[model samples]
Target chain A: DTAVSQTPKYLVTQMGNDKSIKCEQNLGHDTMYWYKQDSKKFLKIMFSYNNKELIINETVPNRFSPKSPDKAHLNLHINSLELGDSAVYFCASRKRFQETQYFGPGTRLLVL
Target chain B: DQQVKQNSPSLSVQEGRISILNCDYTNSMFDYFLWYKKYPAEGPTFLISISSIKDKNEDGRFTVFLNKSAKHLSLHIVPSQPGDSAVYFCAASAIGANSKLTFGKGITLSVRP
Candidate 1:
């Protein structure tokens, strides 16, 4: 069983299209997060949810939205996806604030 | 702006030697520092961390050292193994930020067998 998992590990879509990346965690954590790793290998946190409530929202584009239906799941939906959005998106979970975050295998998105 | 920086993009070490990865942060607001190891297709795995309150924390062969005065931290792996070959990312965040980690550019560590 995967402690943290994401679906469609590989994603290929055209620019301006809409796509979603699904994530789930079984660690019984209180917080979940979404991070984007760019081509230069820079990882940046996009959003974090605590107990199904939005907690941290970095200055990411409005096109990137994070929806957490429950404590264990956080899904990312990108609208009007741009070529610059081509990167590996990672999902993670944490027990609480400032705790270690367990990450998923990542979804590699390629925008053509 | 990149608050966390990993100046070295890559490092090579011989098996059984010690591997040291350095990180620096411009923002003193960062109260915690962590190092993560990532393989090809998988996400990063937590390697070690050090809180701002402490200077050092050890786990098995890995040890994290933090120097708050210098705004610097490092991950030291003793007797580096081939399996440890991966990209290592240095991340940091404030305690109240709910784990909003700002990660470095990452350093690819290659342990030569």
Candidate 2:
């Protein structure tokens, strides 16, 4: 079993369309995070949820929203996606008080 | 602004030799540092880590050295193997930041066999 997994490994959609990326972790971690990697390979944190509560929110656009129905699953929904939003989205999780984060394979989203 | 920086985008080393990857951070608040290895089409896997309180931590063939005074850290792989070829990312976090990692662009390590 995968420690972390994301749905729609590759997403191709037209600009202005809405899309959602689903994430799940089997590591039984309390902290879950979403990170975006741009074309330059720069990884930036977008949101973090701890125990089903929003803990960290970067200066990401409001069009991007994260929902954590439970500690194991954290989903990201993007509204009015733009071409600039095309990048790989990663889901990560770690145990409480643990410094290491385990990441998912990643979802490659392309906005045409 | 990038808090953590891996100046070298790519590095080449011969197998069975020593491989050293360096990282620097501008933020003094970072108390924990980590290195993750990523292969094509895969997520990053935690390789090694070190806390600011300590200078060195080792795991098998991997070792991490943290120089807090210099705000620098380095990952050393002894007897590097071809399997060690991958992109290594440098990450840091503050103690009270809930371990929210700040990642560098990453460095591609090539261990030529």
Candidate 3:
């Protein structure tokens, strides 16, 4: 069974388009996170939610928003995507007390 | 600014030899450190971790050593196999900080037979 899964493993959209990426975890984790890995292979955290509550927001632009409908699901929505938004987005989850994170396969986004 | 740094972009090692990947951090607040391995088209998987209090952690062929004074850490894989080739990431996090991990640009390791 896949512990963490992300939908639409590949996405290609034009500038000014709106897109959303869905993520779900079956590991019974209390925390979920969204990360952006750029072309340089630098992985950075974008947002983190614990039990559906926003806990960490890493100075990301307001155009990007993360919503967690429940403890098991966290989704990312981009408004008016720009060319600079093209990158690999990863979804991760971890238990409240566990330090190790479980990551999904990742979604490659290309905004032309 | 990046808090975690992996100076080496890539490392090539022979099979059955030891592979060492180094990482450094600038933040003293970080209390936990971890190493993750990633393959192409796949997300990173947890490989090993070490706490700030301990200097070393080992799991089978993988061993992580921590130097608190230097704020440096390294992952040592002994007798590396060809299947062990992948990009390795170093991550750090502070306790009670919602477990937010700060990651460094990964280093690619190629284990050649």
RMSD of each: 1.2, 0.9, 0.7
Tens-digit per-residue lDDT, B1-113, candidate 2 = 88999999999999999999999999998999999999988889999999999999999999999988899999999989999999999999986646699999999999999
TM match of model 3 to true structure: 0.98
| Local distance difference test, each candidate | 0.92, 0.95, 0.96
Better of 1 and 2 by DockQ: 2
- State the number of backbone clashes in model 1: 0
Docking class of 2: medium
Per-residue lDDT for B1-113 in model 1, tens only?
A: 88999999999999999999999999988898889999999999998888889999999999999999999999999989999999999998888746588899999999999
Top DockQ hit: 3
Which candidate number maximizes lDDT?
A: 3
- Candidate 3 — what's its lDDT? 0.96
Model 1 residue B99 lDDT score = 56
Residue-level lDDT tens digits of model 3 in B1-113: 98999999999999999999999999999999999999999999999999998999999999999999999999999989999999999999997748799999999999999
Colliding pairs, model 3: none
Q: After superposition, how far is residue B74 of candidate 1 from its true place, in Å?
A: 1.3
Candidate with the larger DockQ of 2 and 3: 3
Q: Going through the candidates in order, what fraction of the true interface contacts does each contain?
A: 0.80, 0.83, 0.80
Q: Provide the lDDT at A69 for model 3.
A: 99
Per-residue C-alpha lDDT of model 1 across residues A20-107, encoded as one tens digit per residue: 9999999999899999989887888899999999988989999998999999899999999999999999999988855688899999
Quote the lDDT for B20 in model 2.
96
TM-score of the second chain, cand. 3? 0.98
